[model samples]
Target: MLLYTAMPLELVLDGIDRKYNFKEIDVDGIKLIIEPIDINHGKIVRLISTNPQDYLNSELSPGKIIEFKM
Candidate 1:
């Protein structure tokens, strides 16, 4: 298991439906769900794994940076 840390980039979705609020991304072949907690502060994100075992084995502590690519 590996831990990733970095400053998370805020994604501004334009012309997107509110119903589709969550963002999905693939990291190292692992599918993760990025749920926005507070848009105003741009801090405190919830990273959810599709597999529960992966989530339990992995640790995403505070002060870790989150990076994204295009």
Candidate 2:
């Protein structure tokens, strides 16, 4: 993990900002990361759940489109 260089830290860490906007929302106790496609819909970026059974839901799969308010 050593960066053996004389370049400034800012220069070396450039372009770290995310271009796509991802929002975290909790629906029915399951947390999800969503990438908005429109005002009321988004594509599921990831699902955060502790239960292994929660991950089996097809609708919660990444890349699936879902509706959301706000």
Candidate 3:
């Protein structure tokens, strides 16, 4: 499976409902919402990818972690 590294941009239980037109790669097609402070500046970015596996679904519940190309 393709891999993705996503950094939290904001964290809200129902954050998707707030965004006007957000798109994600989860089986449910919803992107996870996380706060920018949770991730390191050098980590991966959010959205901007067509590959479903290119992003880590923040809704994983236990919390999301991503690995990026060095």
Write one digit per residue (lDDT tens) for candidate 3, span 10-65: 54234666644322333245444433333331222344446566455453432344
Q: How accurate locally is residue 30 in candidate 3, as Cα lDDT from 0 to 100?
A: 40
Measured against the true structure, the TM-scores of the candidates, in listed sequence, are 0.33, 0.71, 0.19
Show pairs that collide, candidate 2.
Answer: none
Q: After superposition, how far is residue 52 of candidate 1 from its true place, in Å?
A: 6.4
Name the TM-score of candidate 3.
Answer: 0.19
lDDT, model 2, position 31: 98
The digit string of per-residue lDDT tens for model 1 on 2-64 reads: 535574433333445556455665566666555544543221135555666665543442223
Best candidate (score: lDDT): 2
Residues 1-70, candidate 2: write the lDDT tens digits.
8878899999988888849789999989999999999999999999999999989999899999999865
Candidate closer to the true structure by lDDT (higher is better), 1 or 2: 2
Error of 3 at 21 (Å): 19
Q: How much is the lDDT of residue 69 in candidate 3?
A: 28
Candidate 2 lDDT (Cα, 0 to 1) = 0.92
Off by over 4 Å in 1: 1-20, 36-53, 57-65
Count clashing residue pairs per candidate: 5, 0, 4
